[model samples]
Target: MDHMGADPDPDGRTAREQLKSERERDARRRRARRRFSVVGAVVVVAAVIGTVFALGGAAEDEAEGRPLVVPANTVGEQRTSVLYGKADARHTLSVVVDPRCAPCARMEAALGRAMRQLADKGAYRIEYRLATVEDDARGGKGSRWAVNALGAAANEGPEKFVRYLDAVLAGRSGREEWDGDALASPETLLGIAGRVDGLRTPAFDKAVRELTYLPWAKKVAAAHNQNGDEDALPAVTLDGSTVTVLGDDGVPVSPGEFIRQVRGDKG
Candidate 1:
C-alpha cells in the first residue's frame, strides 16, 4: 500500500507530458530560425535596390555638371547659320539675310563697318543667317550661286567669310545687272574671294563651282522662313526677341542706328 505514490503514474503519463513539452520547444525554435532567415533575405534585397538607385543618381549628377552644347542641326559644316558670339556675352544680335534682297544689301552696306567695330569691341555677338527667299522664288536660279559661295567662304574662316560678305555687299551697289547672269557667277565670286587675302583657295573655288553648299544654303533659308513672318526678309532679333529699330526722331532708323541701339548707345 505504501507504493501508491511511486506507482500513481506507472502508465508513463509524466514522461509523455515532458516529451510533449520538448517537442513544442523544438517547434518554436524552428519557427524563430525561419523568421530570422526571412528578415535577413529582406535586408539583403533592400541593400541591393539601394545600391542600384545610388549608382543611377550619380550618373545623372555627372551629366548635369557638363557644359551645355548646341545641337548639331543648328550648326553647319562651316558653322553657317550658327550663332556667333562670346560665350559670356550679355546680348545676341541675329541677322537673317538673303543674298539677293536689296534691303539686306542696303543694310549690310550701311552697317557693315559699325557692326564690325562693335563686334571687335565685344559690344555684342553677331550671328549671320543666310536665306534664298528671292532666288528660290525666281526658279532657284537667282541667288543660289551667291548663297553657296558664301557658305564656301565660311568654310575657310569666319574672318574670311566676313571679308567676302563685305565685298559682296559692296559690289551690289549701282550694279543693277546683279540679278540673273551676275549673281555669284564663277568668275564674279572667285574674283570677290580673291580680293580677300587667303580666301581664294582651290578647295573654296571647287566648292563654289560645284554648288557643294547649295543644300545647306537651302536649309538655312528654310530655318529663316520658319523662324519669322514670311514678309520679314531681313528679320533681326535681339536675344531671340524681335525688335524694331527707331531713331531719335521717332522714325525707323537706318542700319547704323540699329547697331547703336543694339549697343545700348542709342534709343
Candidate 2:
C-alpha cells in the first residue's frame, strides 16, 4: 500500500535518520570545541593580567602586598644552573620541568628561542636548571634523564648541555615512552649524552653513574616550591621580585613585554 512515487526505497528512511544523527554528533563536537577555546582564552588573559599587575607593581589591588621571590644561592648551586640564559648574563631563568608533562617541552622550546633572541641583541643571558617537582606523579624518570644529561653537559660546558637539552625536548629519543627504555637506562641516555661535546669520555660516563650532583638537584627543586612559594613551571621571576609570567595556564605574553617590564627597559 506504500506510495511508489513518495519513496525511492524502503531503506531511504533509515539512511536519512542515520545521516541526521551523524550531523547532530558533529555539531555537538564543534560546539564543545568552541566553548573550550573561549574558556582557555579567558583563563590565559586573566593570568597575563595578573602577571602585569604583579610585575608592574600596580598597587590598586595589592591584596598580598607584592610577595618577594628569594634567590637560590646554595653552596652546591652552579652559576649555569641558576637561570636559562647564556653565561655571564645578569638575569636567570630557573625552569622546573617534568619530562612526562607535554607542556614542559613546549616551554623549553620557547625559552630557548627567547634566549637566542636576547643573546643576539646583547640584551641578557639566561641560566638553566632542570629541576623536578615532588607532585609529579610519574616516576620522575624524565627528570632524572634531564638532571643526568644536564650534569653531563655541565661537566663539558653549558653550551653542550643546552644543545643536548634541546634534543631531549624535541623528542630526539621519542618523548612518549611507557617502559622508560629511552631515558631510564644509563647506557641509552649516555649514548645520547656522548654526542654532546666534552661529555664523550669514560670519565663522563662514570660521573653520570655516580650522580654526585643530585643534592644540587634537590636544592633547586626546593628553591621554587618552598613554603609559600607558589610559582609553577614556565613561571619567570624578574629581578628576584616580580612574577613576570606563568606558563602553567598557557598564556602567550610576548617576551619583549616581559623584558621591558621586568628589566625596566625604557625602549
Candidate 3:
C-alpha cells in the first residue's frame, strides 16, 4: 500500500523537530536584539552624562577665571565694604573719599603708595567708602557721575578700580571748576578709565555711558553722610577709630608717618 512514502513518521516527528529548531532560533535572535538595545541605551546615557559634566566643568572654570568687582555696603543685600585687600584682615582702614575733593586727592597722592604697601604686607586692609559731598554741595552731578564711573570700574576688579581712582585723583586739583568740568562728560571719564589695564570692558563702558551705578553712588553718598560728618571728605579711620592726619602738635603727618600710624608702628 506504499506506506513508506505515505507516512514516513506517523506522529510527524520531522515537522515537530523543524518547528522546535525554528522556535529556538527565534528565541536566540530576540535575546541578541534585547542585549544590543540595552547596550546601546547604556552607551547613549553615558555619552549624555559625560557631555553634561564636561560643559558644567567649563562653565565653572569660566566663572572662577573672571575677575569680580565688588560694591560693598550699597543698596543691595550683598553689600561689601572691601574696596581692596583681604576682607578678613585683622586691621581695617576705612577711608571715606570724594573723587572731586582736592583734599582727598592730596591724601591719596601722599598715602596711596604707602597704603597699598601696607595692604600688600597684610598689615592692614583698606575699605574705600564713596561719597559725593562735593557734587551735592556744588549743585552738580559731576561727583555723582565720577563716583558712578569708579563704581563701574570696580566691577572689573578691586585693582582696576584702584587704578581708575588713582587716574581720576591725579587729574584733580580740588577746585570744583577744574575737577567738575574735567569729569563732567562720560568721554573724559572713559578716556581716563581706558588707560587702566582691564578697566575698559564693555560692561564698564556701558555703565559709565548709561549711568548705571548712579543710584548706587547716591545710596553710598547718602549712607556715608548719615553715618559720619557730611562736611568731611577723605576721613580716615583705623580699626574703627577715626585717625586724624594732624598729630597732637596740629601738624599733618608725612606720608611715611601716616603709613606708620596706620600700621601701629608710630614708635
Candidate 4:
C-alpha cells in the first residue's frame, strides 16, 4: 500500500498556502505600520515645536482678534506657490499643506466650498496660494505625489488644479498607501497635468523635467517649519500674515468666518 495517501485534499494545500501567504503579508503590513508610526511620531514632534514658536505670532492674532497684515509687497515679487483662485482677488490666502496630512485636505475642501459659495454669490475674486510643507527627506511617496500633483495643477491652471486637488484630498482617507508608481512616476504627474485644458504636452513634460517648484517647495517647508514643527498640514495664512492651525480635533475653522474676518465684515 502506498503511504502517500492518494494526494491529500487540494483544499488542504490551498489552505496551507493561503495561511502562509497571509502570515507573510501580515508581517509586511506590521513592518510598514511600524515605519509609518515612527515617522508620524517624528513629524508630530516637529509640529509641536513649530506650534510653540508659531504660537508667539498666532497668540497675538487671537488676543487682538486681528493680526498685523504683512503687505504682499513685503513678500515682494515672489508669487506664492499656493494660489487658490484667480491671481487677482481682493484677498489672497496662502496655504501650506502635506498630502498625507488629513487636516490639510479638510482645509482644502473648506476653501473650495468657500470659493464656490463666493462664486455663486458673484464674489469670486479671492486668490489662494498653496504651498507644501512636506520635508523631502522624510515625506516618502505621499509627499512627493502631493508636490508633483500640486505642480501639475498649478502649471495646467487653477480650474484643473482645483478639481484634481479636490479629488485627491476628498478621497485620501480611502487610499491604502503612498507606494508604487502612482506616487512615484513623473508620468503620473504629467497625466494629471494633462487633465488641465489646453496644457501643451511639451510644456507639461518640460515642467515636470525642470521641477521649478522643487526648490520653492523646500523653501516653503523651511518657512513653515521655521521652528521645526512637522505635525500639521493645511497651515493657513490669510492675506500673507495670519497663521491658523487646524484645531486639535482636525475640524477646520469656519471658512466663512475666516473670509469675513479677512474682509472685515461686520455682518
- Give the distance in Å from residue 240's predicted Cα in candidate 2 to where it truly belongs: 3.1
Report the alpha-carbon TM-score of model 4 versus the true structure.
Answer: 0.51
Tens digits of per-residue lDDT for model 2, 84-196: 34456565444445443445565556555665566546465554545565235454344654564456556665556667666666552245433442454456667666556
lDDT of candidates 1 onward, in order? 0.66, 0.53, 0.71, 0.53
Q: Pick the candidate with the highest TM-score.
A: 3
Q: Give residue 164's lDDT in candidate 4 (0 to 100).
A: 64
Best by lDDT: 3
Superposed on all Cα atoms, model 2 deviates from the true structure by an RMSD in Å of 17.0
TM-score rank, highest first? 3, 1, 2, 4
lDDT of 1 by residue, 42-115 (tens): 99999997885575345335433544322222343445574444535676677777776666666666666666
Task: Tell me how many clashing residue pairs each candidate has.
Answer: 0, 8, 3, 12
Give me the displacement of residue 166 in model 1, in angstroms: 1.7
Mark the regions of model 2 whose C-alpha exceeds 4 Å error after superposition: 1-90, 134-136, 172-182, 194-198, 241-267
TM-score of each: 0.61, 0.53, 0.65, 0.51
